[model samples]
Target: MTIIGWMIVFCEIAFWVVIVLGLMTRYIFKKKQLGIILLALTPLVDLTLLIAAGIDIYRGEVATTAHAIAAVYIGISIAYGKSMIEWADQRFQYYVTKQGEKPRKRYGIEYSKHYFKGWIRHFIAYIIGGGILVGLIFWIDDISRTQALSGVAKIWSIVLGIDLIISITYFIWPPKEKGISSGT
Candidate 1:
């Protein structure tokens, strides 16, 4: 893997690590302020990745798949990071701190709604990430240097389409709840 690839991996690891530390501090150590501060730092991790990608492109390095992925990662993180953190916090509160009820699993129409919400987040990620990729392409001003970014955009667009279809299907035919009869 290239340096950018390694940086992407590092950023991902750092993002999760920060979240875990924040939650642990809040729930385990009872240091709520420090935990909030740590949780708030998730954006900084994304910013760092963005800066690195920008610098790499600015320095005339050919953009690679890793670079394109970095943009996508930032987009997804921005779009879903809060929900993800909330998800973890809920689980931690229920399982670890025993302060809250267990997070309920959605079923039937509720499950479909959950899927739709997830699809919306994915759409937001595509827009943000695609915009960044286009910006990088324009900034590079060289087709050869930006092919990887373009490819990533195309592939991500396809994925977005597929996600939408899947999300819609959940609404069209809501998943049956386990052990529930269909009046057969």
Candidate 2:
């Protein structure tokens, strides 16, 4: 198998482990699942883009496979971030209703610091993370990559690093809530 092929196998294995571990934590513990679900799907997202981008890379349509992978990571980060933000909003609404407070209709609010996260924060975070990934890819592609495995490894590491960093940031630095802000 080619270096690219081996790299794919390595990533797939890593993703499978993450998926299983996430499932165990979310399901067994009956935990809030939005973030865990996103974690589980990262590998699938990466795999899909790698296959698609590999073709373009071979054809020289993309500057490199890394470029294609970077684009895919950006897309997935945005989607996953949006989903988690929405889930948190809905969850907050449910809690408010249960507590006999009027739930913010057609908008979100931070009832508490823990519950006061904003979707726009997620949006901005994803944008910044994606920007970093794309920027690095562009930087790296300036040099010729003779060893496909090494170049692919660099790409994989970048994507994985961004994923970890973004996930941690969201987990640790969740958005602070303001007044029951509604969209105009």
Candidate 3:
């Protein structure tokens, strides 16, 4: 892997590690702001990695394994960032403030609405992020460099397909009860 690719790999690993550890510290260690700060900074790592990758491609380096992994990491993050953060936040709230109370969302329009919003966000992210990847592919090609754009595209298509399936399933299986109005 190129230096850029290795950087991406390192960044991706660091991103998840930070988030997980941050959550543990925030909830388990009772350090809320510090943990949240660490979790929130994970995206900056992604941004730096992306800048490095972009610079590499701009300088005519062919994409490598690291690039491919980074592409998937970016795609997944774009699609799931909000939902994942919300999930973590809910868990944190339950443990930290709710005092062991189980978090619940009543099945209602609001329930469906929140998920539908998430679906739209994920779909839009796939489009924008996928376009960026494709643009990078073309850019690399235009400069006479051979990158694994096709392979990356294939992987993206699978991600899109999976997201679509998930959204559809969520829509079809709406909850039947009324959701509670907890100040989120």
Candidate 4:
């Protein structure tokens, strides 16, 4: 395995560990700032691994299975990082600050509005993420542009389909009511 390959392994481990520890620190230990800092640093792990992979490819290494997997990882992280972080933040607030019994939706209207906004946000993210991946496809020498771009397109389409299903389900079976302000 290449150094980049090892870095990907380390990064994947560190990413999840950071999330777990961050949640533990914030929720269990009540160290919000420290936990948030750690959580915010999760992308840096991905970034480091990506840079290492780029360097490896630049040094004339062919794109291996490891590199392709790393590209997929990086692509997802880039595309969904904002939405994932938002979700975690809301979950933290709902459980800890609000002391809510659960994180499920309370009202239909407000929840619909929030869900629509999230869909829009994620749509924009997909576009930006796709563009970035296209750029990176150019940067990495051994990867096939057509294949990678096609893969990215498929990912975006899949995500879109899932989001649509969730939206329809939300319309059909809305959550029980709390207050308008508490839907987050």
Best by TM-score: 1
Residues 12-101, model 4: lDDT tens digits: 788778887787788778998999898889889888977886777677666555665576677667667766766776676677667535
Tens digit of per-residue lDDT, candidate 1, span 1-184: 9888998999999999999999999989999999999999999999999999899888889999999999999999999999999999999899888999899988899999999999999999999999999999998999999999999999999999999999999998898889997788
lDDT of 3 by residue, 1-184 (tens): 5787678668868877887788778877899899888888877877887788787777767776566566656766767776777676677668655655577765746666777677677667667566767777776665335356656667767876786676567667666654534445
TM-score-wise, the better of 1 and 3 is 1
lDDT of 3: 0.71
Residue 167 local lDDT, model 3 = 59
The TM-score of candidate 4 is 0.60
Check candidate 3 and list the clashing pairs.
Answer: 106-179, 107-177
| RMSD of every prediction | 0.9, 11.8, 6.2, 6.1
- Order by lDDT, highest first: 1, 3, 4, 2
Tell me which residue pairs clash in candidate 1.
none
Kindly list the per-residue Cα lDDT of model 2 for residues 76-121, writing each as its tens digit. 4554544653454445435632433444533122322233233344
Scanning candidate 4 in windows of ten residues, the lowest lDDT window is 141-150
| Candidate numbers, best TM-score first, in rank order | 1, 3, 4, 2
Residue 34 deviation, candidate 2, in Å? 16
